[model samples]
Target: MFELRHVSKRHGAIIALDAIDLSIAAGQTTALIGPSGAGKSSILRMLIGLEWPDAGEVRFDGVPLRRETLLEQRRRIGYVIQEGGLFPHLTGASNAALLARTLGWETSRIEARLRELAELCQLPFAALSRYPAELSGGQRQRVGLIRALMLDPAVLLLDEPLGALDPIVRHDLQTQMRELFALLNKTVVLVTHDVAEAVWLGDTLVLLRAGKILQKGGIDELLDVPADPFVHQFMNAQRRLREDA
Candidate 1:
């Protein structure tokens, strides 16, 4: 569904991604996990064309991502970031319907789609009428998911979607997210720092560090035959934290 070939991206003096090659399978959920500065979010941004590689290529459905076609390509992809990335002034419904409105969808069609997605994401029907500032953290995240899934895109790119929510909300949403992924069967790329979250929700895990991929495979493979010491430590970090706690 997506491919990054020798991709290198730098933000000024910072190297966000360095000559990394990756391929995300269609109809599967792949998690990008690593520590700070590991380039997980950078990869997600590139996939959606918000950022471009300084060298190498980023391809979607076999076509190289180009500026001229980025907007069109984006319509086929849904993306959500932390805290929903909602506009401060817009109502949750308005934020979720932004793309459809831009595409000239009718008001009735937009409202109908919003109703469908609100239910899918398990968001309260009345919450859509509230502004971003008026919603709780979980509600805001749900609003974000509704926005991302509103267009019924072929791919979903989530960058730390649950990172900010409380543990209770996060746990519940994890189940919902997994069900949604399986039900939708879209190519999903998730960026997270939590190994347990990645293992639980992802079909495949891609561990990165300092802008390079150190390991990529199933949870068992990563746990049993880690590519490096960092992979082993990272995969077991949750257990280690528990033991220490």
Candidate 2:
């Protein structure tokens, strides 16, 4: 549903992304993985129209990304970033209903949707009245996810959404996230440095490095036929690492 064609972005002499081309299909999850400075976040930024490419184009459903249609297109996609990014003062329900309020949804409709989302995300009804400061890291992340999914966007972009949680909470959220995505059938593009996370959440994986794509394919394809030694090593290490005790 989204396509990036030969896109490149630069900051003076530094290249943030280099000739990157990617496509995210409907009702599928694609993960972007690599070391830091690999242009993973840059790709998300471009997709969300937060950053424009210096060359080439980013298109959503065949339409070139434009300022006029950006808000409409964005409303059709959900995004969650690292650290939850919730307003410190807004209650969880308020946060989740932000978009709905903007769209002129009635107070009752917003309340009902908030309740439904809380249930879907396995959060307590009481959480609706709590602020970010009152919740644990995991709770905050779940609230963030619910906020993004409130409008039931066709596409979801998650940029290291689980990074700030504790290990156990992270693992639990990972499973919950997978189940939620499958149930919703949303087109998902997730950015994570963790190779295991990429494999677990993505039907297809793209390994990036130095602002360029190193390889992209299904999990089995990449594991069985790595593009180079770097990919081979990455896959092997991920396979061998044991869960933290």
Off by over 4 Å in 1: 240-245
Give me the displacement of residue 233 in model 2, in angstroms: 2.7
Q: lDDT for model 1, on a 0 to 1 scale?
A: 0.91
Model number with the top lDDT? 1
| Candidate 2 backbone collisions, by pair | none
Worst 10 residues of 2 by lDDT: 236-245
> Which stretches of candidate 2 lie above 4 Å from their native place?
241-245
Backbone clash count for every predicted candidate, in the order shown: 0, 0
Give the whole-model CA lDDT for all candidates, comma-separated: 0.91, 0.87
lDDT of 2: 0.87
TM-score of each: 0.95, 0.95
